[model samples]
Target: MSETTHAGNGISTEQAGVEQELVDTVLASFDKAEDPRLMEVMQALTRHLHNFLREVRLTEAEWNTGIDFLTAAGHITDDKRQEFVLLSDVLGASMQTIAMNNQAYKGATEATVFGPFFLEDAPEIPLGGDIAGAAAGQPCWVEGTVTDTSGNPVPGARIEVWEADEDGFYDVQYSDSRIAGRAHLFTAEDGSYAFWGLTPTPYPIPHDGPVGKMLKAVGRSPIRASHLHFMVTAEGLRPLVTHIFVEGDPQIEIGDSVFGVKNSLIKKFETQPVGTPTPDGRDVHSQSWARTRFDIVLAPGSDLR
Candidate 1:
């Protein structure tokens, strides 16, 4: 019998060496990948994955369970919904990748998760126009200035914004073709932009899928902190995707399901009582409103980009 086949009461060194041999064999198959980066990634993935499985001494049943979970996620992902991104978000993989790529530079605004709801065809809003076409929520006035790291104004910067309505549902969640709570607008020559939208409230990520089941299995909450999404781009600046989380959200104190909350991103959404004067002098009738200002700074473009 082969030495590797010998059974023992405890884990044997020979078995460990045999497992490593299998890992090396798998990694060697990636050597012909024309891309050196792909080869490196494959090799590293093999090593880490094998190490984790060995560390946990995963059983055949557990491995099958994992495969089934991934299959379920794949089955649920589609054009409007992304189950894999949700899985990555819940596992902190998305945030880790964001952190590794978006290292601190100057005073550039911090980036966060680009949640699954962003749409490429969001309607355009003129400066100081309204984005809430038909979404239902308390009204909010969002204004911000886009500037470079040096604090110079960045004119013509495109700002994309989206958020869920009062009931914590994004426009894409509707059955009928409804678009609301999302729009894009260009910064003015002075780098200022404003829009009327819904006041953000804490919302649960789509929890009816495989990712949600996994979260429930681990006794974790699927609730994310209340925040509005932003994606900013310009001529010579690194694109910024981030959020301004509403202050005092209970989920922020407990924890954002996606681990996306940053202290710098937290801002107070000041409440305006009924009949208070509105910015831009727009009429809100007898309903109170909310207002917030987010100043965005962009990092310079890099040669590699």
Candidate 2:
């Protein structure tokens, strides 16, 4: 191989070796990171990132465009909206992280994306309580039980649930500062829980920002499959974050925007005609509703292995 010199930094100018020396220099710089995990992560990230750049032979203009897009995303992000999380979801990064951290154990429910819409300190509801606090959607009867892999009840497990309204907006997305479509509730001594929530519905991700523009450029749709979010926490079990996707939803065929749909997570949201007897006898005059059962199983301990 003929060695051509590219003056300044003494970087190799050989065809295949052009980027190798720079990669080595960057990896070596992380040797003193003090934290072994950080060092490993940085070195691995550097290698894969460099490999991507080299594989694409990315032009300076394309690189600058990416920077500009991220800058725009940052500017639009605030306490209420997270543009970066949306970006990660569209790129499959969020699901990949969840898969790596949520190890499979006996009968334990799988974990999915912890979307940006989650709010802290959601209101607590009683058994068969309604969480729709004013958001409009068909009433959904959600009942479930929390148990260990051995079928032992996890009494008093706290389940946090949240979902978008029928119009595809979370409570936080509204400028009025209203709170609805989200709440937490604990299980009974028998590990059973129930509440009234909206039936899952398909919705587009926040698409008025930089991530939206990128999706357009890539010919991708921003639609997420219909799903209801759940986060279950018990005293001695691993925290489970997941969603129950609606079965037979046409959107699933197209794929979830966040790549979060799992076959095990899909459940039947059965439609009940008007005048059906309510489980808790909550009145919904002349309104049809839906019902679903999602029994949860949590693995013991918090080890991510």
Candidate 3:
């Protein structure tokens, strides 16, 4: 190879002429990065990426197409929606990540993906109030207690809850003046919380991205199981992000589109007489809902694991 002198950065121009050379040079500069965590992540990323490229003999056109797909995914995002999250849901990455860190909360309500639809600062409803906005689906009365893994009650804990209506749509999916079907409630003195809501339904993820295309290519459905999303937390305790699956929902056993449902999370809800009052004294006569119980046992320490 012919050596050519270059003025900038001291290397011979021939060694620095190619795009790959520039990438390597930029990566090499990270060796002196002060943050250990950042350096570890960057080094692993570089190693895996280089290995992938070499293993697949990746072509420039293929790499460019991947970039374009990701760009298109980002372009489809909006304030109330996240296309990248939908992509993760379809690719099972969301559940995998949740499972990885949630293992320590083993005996607790098993954690699941906090799908993109959760609203921040949800309306603060009272302990037994309904979060469901509209008259949709059969009524369901969900009752649960928040406790530590040691079986001790956790009073004053907060549980943020959200779920889809009967039609498998979130409130954000529509633009009416109706309140969002979500709520934040503080646990009662007995570590208990109860609420009225409609039964959950399987829902489709956004199907207009490369992730959707991948799902189609694999002959898989994009519908997630009917379940409730909960983020429960108490002072001095690790927060819990989890779901309660409706028993008999075939999607739970077969396969959730996001691979989120766990067998231990399934709870059976039984229909009760319309005139019957719930444990919290709410009359069911108006909607004829069923009752289901869920008790969450939080893992201790600062880490939920």
Candidate 4:
């Protein structure tokens, strides 16, 4: 008979001995994977998963609850709602992956989680146009330039922006077919772009799902800091998907639900009085308006596949 050993959880030697054998068995099953990357990933995933279970001494009830939670998360996901991504964000996994993929490039904008609400083929708005649609919110003017890491302009770059209304709800939140606070536009000759948006306001992430329940169970809030989402792309440079956080937002200091905020992305939103001239040559009619500038620097190099 093999020598006996006891785990921290008092798991018997026979049980702990079978654990490594189990991991080895699972890894061996992936030996026939056609892709080498697939085999490597499977082996690593098996090792990590086994290690996690062994370290935590997970119980059957807890494992069942996790499975149920994931099942519910998938059940609620659809065209407009992505509960899985929300789950990943709250787990800090998404941010960790982003940090790993986006190595530091001098002058290049730091990347963050691409929250679940970004829509493809968002309405295209011309320069100096308004993207707020009919959404109710304080008007905000957003202007910026797209440049390479070396400070050279990236002409004709595509800049996409989206945000929630002052009510902290995105256009997709509504059942009706209304588009608000989302648009895309191209940078002008000198790599400049301008558009009207809404003053960012802190809002809770969609908490009507499994992720919400998990947060509640863990005594965590589901609130995300106020910010506007941006995805900038240009020829011969890596795409930048990021957000500009509103400076002084109480939520900023407290911590974002998804851990997405960065010091460099914080910008002051200046409040302008009525009758102030807008950058696009339009007059501000509201009692007060806000403006912000967010210049983006893209890293040189294309995505390798």
- Candidate 4: lDDT over CA atoms? 0.91
Which has the better TM-score: candidate 2, or candidate 4? Answer: 4
Candidate 4: segments with Cα more than 4 A from true spot: 1-3, 302-305
TM-score of each: 0.96, 0.94, 0.86, 0.96
Model 2: which residue pairs collide?
none
Residue range 1-305, candidate 2, lDDT tens digits = 55554443343468546578889999999999999999999999999999898767789999999899989999999999999999888899999999998878887999999898999999998988989999999999999899998999999999999999999999999999999999999999999999999998999999999998888888999999999999999888889999999999999999898999999999999999999988988788889999999999998876848
Descending-TM-score candidate ranking: 4, 1, 2, 3
Candidate 2 off by > 4 Å: 1-18, 302-304
Candidate 1 wrongly placed segments (more than 4 Å): 1-9, 303-305
TM-score of 3: 0.86
Question: Could you tell me how far off, in angstroms, the CA of residue 266 lies in candidate 4 after the best superposition?
Answer: 0.1
Candidate 3, residue 6: the lDDT equals 53
Give the lDDT ranking, best first: 2, 1, 4, 3
User: Which stretch of 10 consecutive residues in model 2 shows the poorest summed lDDT?
Assistant: 3-12
Candidate 3: C-alpha lDDT: 0.79
Error of 2 at 251 (Å): 0.5
lDDT of each: 0.91, 0.92, 0.79, 0.91
Model 1 per-residue lDDT tens digits across residues 11-63: 67677678879988998999999999999998999989998998788999999
- True-structure RMSD, every candidate: 2.2, 3.2, 6.0, 1.7
Model 4, 1-305: lDDT tens per residue? 34566655666788777887888898899999999998998899989998998899889999999899999998999999999999999999999988888877887899999999999999999998999999888899888899998999999999889999999999999999799999999999999999999999999999999999999989999999999999998878988889999999999878899999999999999998888877766766656899999989999875532
